[model samples]
Target: MAAAAGPATLPAVVEELLSEMAAAVRDGAPISDEHLLSLKFVFGSSAIQALDLADRQSITLISSPSGRCIYQVLGSSGKTYMCLASCHYCSCPAFAFSVLQTGDNLLCKHLLAVYLSQAMRTCQQLSVSDKQLTDMLLIERTQEA
Candidate 1:
């Protein structure tokens, strides 16, 4: 999405999350309500880390042998989210810069999708990382790796 104006400044609160959803539509994903609810949120997060914005591009359930505990977000809308497990971040272009330059977290649309996509952890656990959140929101891909 470079060479384009950055994602609109969407405050991370639950109410403004739709702006990021709208951003995804602009970005070309055309998120459906079914896609939106895929995040499988049990208790609402105060601020959406990833799934609240864009669907986790790709998901690998890293922590789950049964594939239930942990999931990883690989990419979205053909954009690969290279989320390094170390720094707690996603390689999504949106997180490269912060619009406000003040918040501890830059709420990008990809992060929003982490909570909105369908392929989620059916089991419950504690806190999850941003990339893991991305995994939670990913739609299952038919193509094999």
Candidate 2:
């Protein structure tokens, strides 16, 4: 981090890194050592998926039969996270449970927290916005794709 940079810069940098990681994991390759190192440096491996995004969020990491990555976001808060997998389904109990028991609308605080954290790290126009992060996600996504 540069002395001139603000406290928010770090998370923006980390988001760029995570976007790259997301693109990588989406591509069906095993996560590389360099990526693990980045997570360690950025999030300090404090939580389970902190090392692996899906894990820290308690997402059940799975892949479609065709090999597309799938996530079962098992948030204890009873809400689900987003899914970018081919089918793109989230598995929070609130989603399924309510859908089953009653036709109720749903959005989750857990997902909000996770998304904000991720967005801060990845989405530059977000609260923790940074140009470097925005460019990096697209760059990594394109390069990997």
Candidate 3:
């Protein structure tokens, strides 16, 4: 007799779905309504939450002179984390454990907040020089550690 199979992990499921969607797009195949709905269902909740955080002004972006994307996100615990938008990196446990470990390019709430803000052009980013950015990052890293 064949052995029973367990459920696919969340990351595996998401990765497969995305890969299929990308292939379909590349092949010029029309994505059905069901496919769109499935994608929406997978990301809807987190997207809404991220938008809410952005609306609440919890996400502040700092424009880097070197063109690196940086954001300061005020989390639910009133703690701030540095989010690197381009890299989908965050100075938070969720990024370290979930995203980095799983090799999933998933954004945490903080990174999502920054992403939405940038996409909407609503984030008033503070422009900083390279030296200033480096100094600020150094200070923040030291404080967090």
| Highest TM-score scorer | 3
**Candidate topping lDDT:** 3
Give the C-alpha miss distance for residue 123 in model 3, angstroms: 1.2
- C-alpha lDDT (0 to 100) for residue 93 of candidate 2: 49
Model 3 lDDT at residue 60: 76
lDDT of each model, Cα atoms only? 0.42, 0.42, 0.68
C-alpha TM-score for every candidate: 0.31, 0.33, 0.62
Summarize candidate 2's per-residue lDDT along 1-145 as a digit string, tens digits. 6577433222366557657766765676665788667655544423233233433445443333343343334455544344333322234444455433574422232332243334333221212234534453455456434
TM-score for candidate 1? 0.31
lDDT per residue (tens digit) for residues 9-90 in model 3: 3456555665665566557775456655664576656556665776788887787768865788887788888887555678
Return the candidate ranking by TM-score, descending.
3, 2, 1
Poorest stretch of ten by lDDT in candidate 3: 6-15
- Lowest lDDT sum, 10 consecutive residues, model 2, at 119-128
